[model samples]
Target: MSTRAMLFACWIVTFGMVAATVACAPAPVPVDERRPDPGTVVGSPRRLASYPALYTSTSRAERVEYSSRGPAGEPTVVSGALLVPRGEPPPDGWPIVSYAHAGDGGDPACAPSLSPDLRGALDELLGLVSRGYVVVATDYQRSSARGPHPYLDVASSSANLVDAARAAVASVPGASNRWFAVGVSQGGHAAWAANERATDSELRLLGSVSLAPQLDMTDVATDAARGSLSPERVVLFPTLVDGASSTDPSVVPDNLYRGTLSRRTDAAAPCLGDSGAVGTDDARAVPAADYAPATDEDRVRLTAALDARRLPRSPATAPALVAFGGRDSVTSPERTRAAVRAACARGDRVTVLERPDDDHRVGISPEVLDWITALRSGATPRPTCGPEPTSPTSTGPE
Candidate 1:
């Protein structure tokens, strides 16, 4: 055969083999484009409970269930509460505050909406409502979404907060389009993330306030494993495992914890308070060596899953007020400063409030309240990124 014809025949044979291989390959799964957009409300806010005379400023209290994005970006129902003020709103409408509460464990009943005290933030919520702002607090997807709660997952909490803001404004009379994201501890992380995530929605996020935000869960876990965590902070270990497993199923409880924690029965219960409710009584008093990861692979799996959930995933859409206390060992000041520096480097306008003398309880300070007041009054806040000025100002381990 001619050289050209021989080459052509060889080419045809190679092409046929390639075609056969391609045909035999498994079909790729199609992306589900029909998933509802993040923050899309799935249903009307069902009345869970009400407090008519809870606070003088709040004419009424409405706790309800709404819809938000789950950890996997799927639409799911969640719970929240609204504190509407007594008086008439301004011509524009009453400003909104999307309040993210600190961590309350991974159990469904740990939801703030179910608590009569609003998860110990009643005074704070009442104070906000007194200022003529309608407050909206999310119970997070852990309360209603399928699967384990992604404890520190920023995306899930951000979506929940933004969607709660949307749902609250729609459900409550005289609520304005303008709003601020405010949170403490885990909620603080959510507020910081919502500042970035809210840009996707039509909500006008005036600013964000993150108090002692748990920015680096990987570091927290590392500390816990090294026996360096405080006794008060040790309770967070199970929630971290649950959170990692939720985001990445390969990092399950059995893959990480030992003894009582390896089993789901005890580990699945509420874990935040001093109640002997988390795991077993022995689990609470056990050495870090007992509850820490079983193997290096398990540790690596947990680290990767938690690291992916850290904050400042992107520059925020609006200015942020970051408050941290120097003596706060739970959510250490060093980690918070590092997160602020990273955020500033990424073009986020962050204002820092540092109180060297205080500990983790420095959140909801007078200065932070004043900062919110100034922002509500249309004043542009200057970024506090450089050397933090030594002054007198943080939350939960989350």
Candidate 2:
């Protein structure tokens, strides 16, 4: 076995021993207020088939099954990764970066922990881990659970993101409870929502970095149902319908797709880059128009779910750095800007990064890193909300 694999084995055995000892020891009648809860680790972090090879700066990268609350407030298990830096941690422990990845279809196989490649946000995560920040990325319950992935359900996914941090602190030897959230696209919405949800957890949320978050899915879902969704975003229709089906029984494959596309066994078959039902394969070929709801009631049911998941569900729990691209077809720029405005109006300190020429794929750069570094150094971020053409900290196209 490799050294990393051996280390993982040792951690599992040691953790098991500690757990057994704690279980056997007598406990006080009352809970101890002075001691902070170390959070919940559902199972020991095990060695993944692929580990640190993708993250050169990481000394240890392992897959962990962590505890989280589901949509209806029930206990659930989710999958995630814990990436430790290359050297010894600071006295307080290594500060954490809880990452939320974009939608990768509803399939468990699309999970980042299962794949060797980080995908989409590799460079950003690589930079942070290289700079000594421990990183944890949640696959959300949908990726690891028994049902279709709730594509944009911020509440549940954000809980998973924050709980991933809790699990890291409970499981990783030197992982600090101090943490921040970072995400892109769907993940961006998750990160922003996690910022609000983190206040309830034991972990300290310093801030969040959100890139191209899909704030209000209601408009987009409505567009898809009405056959008015922009061509650029039509590829996402299947996933949206699948996600809507996860929450509402009324929305199904047969009523949402045409002919063979509706006949496919796997309703949620598209895996991010693959155009499952929206492509030109004769077996299941169809135009974007074919992907439509059977009735107006189906559209209403889908829209209701999307509306409930809108961002700023409550005022943000921490200051944030939100970057929005003008040309983002997947997430409406107008809606994102509106959400940010609403958050600002609600007394949240949000620093905006408006890149007018960029698209849905916003590049992570040094500026974003500098902002995170400033927060770590105890610098207060200046809020950027004043006028219509808001003055953002970073206005240049990225």
Which digits, one per residue and each the tens of the lDDT, describe model 2 over residues 91-122?
Answer: 88788999998876645555666554554555
Q: How many clashes would you count in candidate 1?
A: 3
* Candidate 2 lowest-lDDT run of ten: 21-30
Candidate 2 TM-score, true structure as reference: 0.81
lDDT of 1 by residue, 227-326 (tens): 6666445656666777777778778676556554443235234346635555334545666775667777777787888889887788788879998789
Q: For this target, which candidate reaches the highest lDDT against the unseen true structure? A: 1
Of the candidates shown, which would achieve the greatest TM-score relative to the real structure? 1
How does each model score on lDDT? Answer: 0.70, 0.68
TM-score of each predicted structure versus truth: 0.81, 0.81
What alpha-carbon RMSD in Å does predicted model 1 have with respect to the real structure? 16.6
